[model samples]
Target: MQPKKKIYIALKFIIPAIIFLISIGFVSKKQEEKLCKKIVITIENQQGNFFINEGDIMDKVTKNGREMVVNLPFDNVKLKDIEQRIEALKFVQSAQVYRDLQGNMLIDAVQARPIARVFNPVGKDYYISDRGEILPVSERFTARVMVLSGSFFRPYLEKNLLIDQAGKDLFNFIQFIEKDKFWSAQFAQLEVNKSGMINIYPQVTKQIIEFGSVADYSEKLSKLKIFYDKILPDRGWNRYERVNLQFKDQIICE
Candidate 1:
């Protein structure tokens, strides 16, 4: 309870607290000192528009191609705005932006996948993906995807994409089929009959495979595999020009 003893105890606690505070402040100061001088941005399948918009935290930063080094007075530079701006492109599917300890920023993203190539009535040819999506041509991004033919082939209107009930059914059916792993790579194109019936044409084998609808894509795909692995490999593509799997658990190949 003596005054000097009480003072010494207080000094022991206060000295350590002050030293801890000073160490934290020094580390923080060093982190801020490592602030980046610029920001780097790169986009894939960008058709020439490469400028990140203003109000972005990365503006006025130094750019070395896609690598941006942002000059930050603080330890962090918020980059959500910059990412959103870059991903606003109709062609861009998703965008990711991040900053390292050195204030270096990176933008990486993958474009959307196109499902079907369409021949619109406007005499313009474009591609439409599985989500009922449509887009113009791209020389740089022509995927080895599927081709579709029906009355649904046309320009993208804000209205309905299907020309009739048949087109809609066929689109849905083929989209599911396209997602199939065993059959998708083997299939080349899909054609819709006026009766809303679906068909699968193989990439290696040239034949018209008559599948009813999306209802039996899994089953029909299995049958198609048998036709290719068991029959087509031995008999050649011309052996079965018309492969029909309309009946239950049966594949009638002619």
Candidate 2:
């Protein structure tokens, strides 16, 4: 091939590649500036009693989110700070604030899912979610959250009411039950006694099944399955006054 012809072909490819890169850069820049053009805050569990307010945006989104806006430009707005503020909200479970491809800022918020009501020894009770989240028990009790009474309640992180490890474990267990369609509406209350024994009270049956501690939780749950399928409905769940699954090998019923 001729040198001039080869050079022309190279230029053709190189020009297009550069133009494409420039276009992408421009698009990205616009996204950063256009983020949050119209802020939309949707509360999934805010009504009657939950303390979710416009002021909750502070710890819920970070810094002063009320004053923040979209299409204003990314240089002026701090993304990390805004995220922190939104997360600070008590009812907010998770938050993600980012600039979309078109340079539009979208603040995505996920509110915590409340599983039960926790009564504390400190004379305080709060709404407990399957994700190990807690909402203060204020004057409002109109929401349909179930109640949980136990010897153990979650300890919070410094000044922040985020639940601790034990609370998180309890939350995971509740999530497991709710995820299963068979047991979703069966449970009414989950109680932890003074001896750290875990008990479940089903709404349909007045009897309480004593589950011992969090250790071997899966094992105890498996035993319950057998009892439910093989024993309960066939023999009548009322056959046992107190169902104990604390032992390693067997379930002893009273």
Candidate 3:
């Protein structure tokens, strides 16, 4: 009976001490949370859109972000607001905001990818992104993609918007050329007129290529490839001033 009584008394004191320790830990955690320290901002360069910098991102965040993030507790930080503000930047394609275990703000972002550059008829220039949206030209970097000039212009509600259907068709046609190794290196410039006639200037040969319309594009490209592989080598590339691939089953050398 004596041993059992001692054991019960020991357990009572140990349990109270344990409860006090737990309460102390909980209070420490709450106190640490209330102390909002430095405003740490991290911006990830996912797609290499070098138009904007980390300072630019933090400026956007602090200017329009929730004051709770910088002044109040870390738990009061508005993550979605930060994300939306960052994504609203002209070059930012997407952005995500979160807090780490140490209450540091982390942001992961991707920049818009430009696939083509368009020189409008009205003497304006912009980039066409892979997602088909129009992007403003960056002062930092220039992409060595396909360039379209002349009267190939499409109306848009805003400058930084997707190309219209007709413009997309033309853009896709240029994309096809860019994807092909031979044509990409050979075709330097693409020009289209108001009548929808397409002309291609090659880097290798002096002959102008009259591509006409986008109709029968695949067939026309196939024929051009055949001429490059079989006929151009034999007949000499300079023999023809112009190569017409507009017709269905004929390669007219003028």
**How many pairs of residues collide in each model?**
10, 22, 0
Cα shift from native, residue 17, model 2 (Å):
36
Q: Once model 3 is optimally superposed onto the true structure by TM-score, how far is the C-alpha of residue 221 displaced, in angstroms?
A: 0.7
Q: Which pairs of residues collide in model 1?
A: 36-70, 36-71, 37-71, 38-62, 38-69, 38-70, 39-68, 39-69, 40-67, 40-68
Q: Candidate 3 lDDT, tens digit per residue, 98-143?
A: 7666756777777777766778756568877766677878777777
Candidate 2, 24-118: lDDT as tens digits: 99998766555555554555554344556554654344345456455566677788878877776666776777775556656667666565667
Model 1, range 1-254, lDDT digits (tens) per residue?
99999999999999999999999999987876578644555555434333223223233232323534445553454467656755665455677877666656666754555677764545666666445656556654465667766553433333334656645666676677567776677778766544456676678767888877656666777787787779877888687689988787887978
TM-score of each: 0.58, 0.61, 0.77
Better of 1 and 2 by lDDT: 2
TM-score of 1: 0.58
Descending-TM-score candidate ranking: 3, 2, 1
RMSD of 1: 8.4
**RMSD to true structure for each model, in Å:** 8.4, 9.7, 4.4
